[model samples]
Target: MSLRSRTAGAVLALAVPFALAAVPADAAPVPEADPFVWTDLTPTYTATADYQYEPFAVTDGYRPIGRCAQGTGTGEGGAGYHYVNPAHVGSLDPAEPAGLLYETDSNGGRALVGVEWIVRADNAAGAPTLFGQSFQGPANLDGVGSVYTLHAWIWKDNPSGLFAPWNPTVTCP
Candidate 1:
């Protein structure tokens, strides 16, 4: 081999390792645990008769907040109906989500799709994170007030991502 070619090959080998080391370790994609496997939420599935805010019933400490429709824009599918448990709002426990998300079918049936973890902005020391994902906002949520929220599309697959606030496949009546 020529001397020039040998030197070029040696340099390339040394550069490769340094280039790889520059990438952040956290940037690597990490596999996450399924967020939907909760046995403790059994009572929420059956408690649909009691009303806490009228029209919306309080089922196992959760009451229906509202349904959000798909927004106009590329990939801006809106979040579905939110059923919030007031008691769970401030806690960051992954097993105890602050709210449940449901998608309404044409037959007027609701299907469980995801879970939401919320912490009121005013009550938080900083942005709250769970499942390695940061909460989205301090935006004002009607009736619930300003809060930081994160959604995990557990039961349903989201095209956007697992932690995305909106799901394109979800629609409301």
Candidate 2:
């Protein structure tokens, strides 16, 4: 082949992948490694009784199921209070987590610590993943049925790992 033709072919080969990889300006931005950093948890809280009350309006669609204390024999830290939004349960969107985790203090104060995404095993096409992490479980969670769950400890630092099921720093009451 001619030198000019060979050079053009090489250029085209390199350019094709870059062109294909370009993201559209309007495309939803890639999720942050810590998706909850910019997330405002104010709307997720209840209107009365500190963190003990269910949200008066349920604006974000999540309601407090109740606090989950540390397991007696599980040897893992607790997941704290769960504010679950039934509408987003099976969704794979990292931005729309199925549950929000909160830890309460000695004085009945509440703090948003993490987020959870859950998909009932029966409803999932396969195992679901978000933020490049796989969900953990087909096991039965208390109120929720058999499901896959992922926890992101964005607010509370987890020594175990970012997606670990339990955070050593998190506690109930």
List model 1 lDDT by residue over 11-130, tens digit each: 435433443443357654433322232222222222221221224434357777755646577767767888888988887776567887777766676766777888999963778877
- Tens-place lDDT per residue, model 2, 1-173, is 96544544554454334333443466565443233422332222211112222342156577777557575645577888888788888877655678777787656755667778889999637678766677898867667788899886655666666678888777665
> Cα lDDT of all candidates, in order?
0.64, 0.62
Reference-based TM-score, model 2: 0.62
Clashing pairs in model 2, backbone N/Cα/C closer than 3 A: none
For candidate 1, give the lDDT of residue 104. 73
lDDT of 2 at 122: 90
- On TM-score, the candidate that comes out on top is 1
List the lowest-lDDT window of 10 residues for candidate 1: 45-54
Count the clashes in each prediction. 0, 0
